[model samples]
Target: MAKNNGDGKLHVAMLPWLAFGHLIPYLELAKLMATKGHKISFISTPKNIHRLPPIPKTLTPFINFIKIDLPKVKDLPENAESTKDLPFNKVKYLKIANDGLQKPIQDFLKTSSPNWIIYDFATYWLGSLASELGIRTAFFSVFPAVMLGFLGPPNVLIHGDPDNNDNDNTIIIKRPKWVSFETQVRPSLYQLTRWGHYNSDGENMSDVYRLGATVDGCDAVFVRSSFEFEPDWLNLVKRLYKKPVIPVGFLPSTSDTKDDDININNNDSSWLVTKQWLDKQEKGSVVYIAFGSEAKPSQYELTQLALGIELCGLPFYWVLIDQRGASDEEVIKLPIGFEERMCGRGVVCREWAPQFKILSHDSVGGLLIHSGMSSVIQGFQLGKPLVLLPFSAEQDLNATYLVEKKLACMVPRDVDGSFEPESLADSLSLVIVKEEGNMYRDKAKEMMSLFGNRDIQDQCLDELLHFLSTSIK
Candidate 1:
């Protein structure tokens, strides 16, 4: 076991992608590193920083937040500091805005001279700046190793442009030349050829470019995963990137269970009501449905999801937040009289609720989630079964990997990736009620030792810290 290296206190500057999914894990990692007595210069936009859960008092002294202004771009919405504020398609403008921070960030590095600067895929240009300043850099991937494996090496991501398909999208849909595993973990036909990679319109800031360049340039790569899971992919990334590939563990919350309330305000009425309703349900009976803060199902999908849960006929707690970032008047409308028909079998909250508290409750038998890494870990933390409804490519990757592991059941979608109510209903019932789903529940429970183990996570952190603490860095 790698012990925390207290002999050398290293400084690590963290800059994750502007999305909440990435930001939260990076912050969790910051907290873990801080516990080793290292200093952290955590950077993000002002609004995102304001929205993040409060840093614990004990770690406050070790972490310093650096907020940079997100430059105004032509198409970006007002106050759209993070991906949560805009639809995924409009996020191209946000990347253009993120690039505007290059100047200020460069200035900070020159002044602080941190031992190592860690960054996400969005900052493809960051490695050059770090190299010039004589500082080491690490590409701290907030994504899982399986997705990166499907992405292949740097050259494949860059030249195999989905639009400029070299072989009629055949190359993408098929498993890469490298992956030796015989599994159904590759991207879908639609994901590969049709609705391919996410890209920004204005500049050379397409996701393919950013991802390829970031991996190609970084000194090393660190994944937010564990050796116990995706072992092949974890080791494959080393051969693919030709760099030090280290698993940062599952990043289970190192904080105590009571600390879940830190993100919730004392006057939070939404949590209060949600908790009261959960108290009424039978233990291990309620399906907790939430697509996360950033993903808002379209009216059609929303209707399908809502009606699907209703069709499942199980007690459920659903937290509904429309990510359209619309005005209050444009509130999410469920199917006409949908709630009335449910007759109190389900509870829906339009406002924010403490997700951790709900997942930890006895009432939550299984989770209906977006398959984001953080949510997946949370479900695994409590040894609960999962019903996955993925919205993006990354989500697809996570969901597919979990399904391959027999720990989750992805809501079956059409070849075009659109899901119907019937499919959603059947998937939920199979996971939460049917005996066939017991394997998923049992597998999730078995994984609790590895995924929820903070000691294992701490040891992974120690190894990474040891590398950062070396004099050469």
Candidate 2:
């Protein structure tokens, strides 16, 4: 067994996928563990580590950042550490490069000999490799517990090779036979046909197999969710996996931030302008619209969104992101003369807006998002009702769960498999403005007590710490 510090404090290491959504939560969890007087070693590419948000002065002592260089691959872009830096077509090469970290990580295990290692799905090899050196491992999932339940057991993950084309869409389109309870979440036929092969272009091992290997080799599964929110799903995961399912809390990005920082030290120029505009609006009147960093709409869909927001006629603030390679001239194209026509009524800022501040503002009443888990958690913390347009299968699962809970309204898609401006307008009106939206608004407000409560968040972390302290190899 890996040795500990002998004070019930363990030395834990963290490794997550190369995406901001994954990295931020892993770092937050690290800070939480470090706060409990445990040691942390956060490993990532040098660039990704440098790009993370500034670490707090107090927690810096306990959190140690270990930067390693990823072995260069054939087509990977220069200094492309995170998903945000690369286009979709090039992401396959990035995965190839990510697999190259096995050697250095093996070296880390040999020298540091941490008591335990918490890892993401992508590093499937780490579990077995760490086990050889007598170290314990846990799978730190950023997805919801229900999704983990949906992925089913280790046998399905291992035996079901994503690259195997026995029955193209027939097998995956249907829900797993293992799911005994009545659940509404499943990957759509279109999503499965399009993105199903675990996004394998030429990679040897698919993402699903990676997840399976990670779970099979790990001692426990640490999910980023709460038992209070989804007890049925949590229980299902436990029964199916037949292993310890530890809910590591929602790990809200705003947990450690002081209340004063929201209003005082948040001096980003982009936020200052946004605050000024929001300050003038009536309380709970504006709609906040943003698709997280990774989920971007096609240009045609962007036009539809522009028209839809215009049709809704509600005062709105839109943050339009220009993808990594887009130049100034390639700014998101709205309908001709769209901004001029909607001046004073709506503003589209291409710059980064402070999302937490915007969602928490009294002037904001609702949020329109792509159902990304991190974004959903942030919005719920401030009790903002959601209008969901999920872009991926995982997002679809989250949207289904929220709709079942009566906390969100889904924008209907056309037979052509694309959403229309009219559907967008109607959905936004129903969730943010119309009289019928009050129920959703009320339910979202009720969730604030669960998502925003720090004591509950700390309690979850305490449970995690307790598990690690007691469960020795």
lDDT of each: 0.81, 0.81
Q: Candidate 2 lDDT, tens digit per residue, 1-473?
A: 58867677899999999887888889889988988889999999988787676667888999999999988998777878877677666666777898999999999989999999999998888888999999989999999987778878887788873544575655654666777888777766655654564376555577778888888889999999998888988898888778899999998756445221112123467767778889999888898888876666767778998999999998899877657433213345788989998899888876556677778889998988989888788878888899998877788788888888787888887534487788999999988888998998998888888887788899999999989988867
Instruction: Judge candidate 2 against the unseen true structure and give its global Cα lDDT, from 0 to 1.
Output: 0.81
- Model 2, residue 296: what's the lDDT? 65
| TM-score for predicted model 1 compared with the true structure | 0.93
Give the TM-score of each candidate.
0.93, 0.93
- How many Å off is the CA of 328 in candidate 2? 14
Tally clashing residue pairs in candidate 1.
0
| Clashes (N, CA, C under 3 Å) per candidate | 0, 0
Clashing pairs in 2: none
Error of 1 at 365 (Å): 0.4
